[model samples]
Target: MPVAVVLPGALNPLAGCVPPFDRCGARARHATGPWASSQGTQILENGDAVDLTWVESAGAPVIVKEESLRNLWGGYVNSDYENACEVDGYAGLVTFGEPTATVTGLVINEIPAPTAFMEEYRSIVQWISSSSDARFVEMVREGIASVSMWDEGPIVRVNGPLAIFDAALPGTEAGADELLLVEIESDTPAPARESIGWIP
Candidate 1:
């Protein structure tokens, strides 16, 4: 029996919660197709269906729906100061603050419409950008380069528009993942598409 860990959303945690044994049983049922003798056998008790290995063997395509895109950000930020010098020396002195790191990136892999998820994502991004405790703003400002989605195929290709950040906000990076995941389930299923940029 193979064990798997499943993380469900906050709203429907139970639906996502599957005991290890139950997971094994479900996998066994899906596999072997109702024509076998024992529940744990690789072949499965039900010969009618295929076993977990069989499903993997058939190579059934695991489509990443619009709701599965993961967003992420990575970078650092620094402060610079300049002061004029008196005497015969360089024109001015430059000073820099300690560098802070952060992570920022959107996982658009399975997201159907990423634009819609921007509001929540932005809130978190903003929080990280301005967080004084973590000092992660620097990283949030520079870490994230771009946000894109990819479809599984012979050659993984970007699926939709690219989301790029214009300015850094406070407290964004700390909870970016949770924010994006929440946004994905806001609406019903739809065809996946790329997002240009989030406004809010």
Candidate 2:
């Protein structure tokens, strides 16, 4: 049985209360089908249906209904969200924080939506931009808080429009393993796309 370690989220200290994935059984890790038809529950062998949200699968598909989509950001869904479905792979994320040594590129693996990549990048910018560089360093030391049950991946590297990462590229496959989400940060307010190269 695989063991899972749930981390505490930034705002929630009790975030790791969920049972480990091994205890939930294999079904919890490899869920199938759509969420809506399941009555929001995962039934165990004894016929007990648990709440779907608490399942904590790393890679699942979530079909947000039209009504729910309406309430998302600006009362409108991101154009990129039109066909989004993958469950958030980085839901209980452990952010690696900005690199101590400058790097040319970054890779944020296994995210659910294009908007999320942008949102996270924006958050890092908002945090670092509003404070002094010393404060940014302090925040890094305080470390990123995360839900204990999620995957750990690279933190936001920089704040670039999705285009720099070629997210909106036509004919690109959605949820493809190769479609990595990346960002670029720079000393300049608006850095050129070439400032940071995306390895993926």
Candidate 3:
């Protein structure tokens, strides 16, 4: 089922995508880490029913959740990812507002990573790092809209609790004042994470 985009506290949509047996079983040998596996069942963000399938592709070990995502969806969604942002323990993948309304991909993160996370991802991280204040605000909003972190594509991990960051950005003073966006949230105690979808 597609996870309702309704916010302000939605139950995790990825709750049962991966089975508990996959968590610790004979499958461990084939997986690079805890959950990023190439085989076994998975639930795409598009709301597709979880099912088993097998394939090969490069994937990163989510040291935090100990999972790997090497399915077709992983590649597709990762391709859409461009940047991310984080604040405190919240983060989200920013895809320039692409039409990911419901597509298959890695889990959207169940809890803020408590252990290691994408080393390079930050609230202001971008394909081309910029010093512009407006750009900074844009990045922050991207994180908030998507709402949470994940291996954006297999290389970077995104981070943010968007509403807060979005609210923090200056909406008015753009045409006036010497706009300056100084800092963005970085390395914080990983709170452990906490995401769905689908159609023709």
Compute each candidate's TM-score over C-alphas: 0.15, 0.19, 0.18
User: 1-80, model 2: which lDDT tens digit per residue?
Assistant: 11111121122222222221244343222223232233234444445333321111233211211111112211011333
lDDT of 1 by residue, 116-142 (tens): 112312322222112221222223322
The backbone clash count of each candidate, in order, is 62, 8, 28
Better of 2 and 3 by TM-score: 2
Considering every candidate listed, which one attains the maximal TM-score? 2
**Which model scores highest in lDDT?**
2
Supply the TM-score for candidate 1.
0.15
Query: What's the distance in Å from true for residue 13, model 2?
Result: 12
Instruction: Please state every model's RMSD to the true fold in angstroms.
Output: 23.4, 18.5, 21.2
Superpose all Cα atoms of candidate 1 onto the true structure and report the RMSD in Å to 1 decimal: 23.4
Candidate 2 lDDT trough over 10 residues, lowest sum = 68-77
Reference-based lDDT, residue 169, model 2: 20
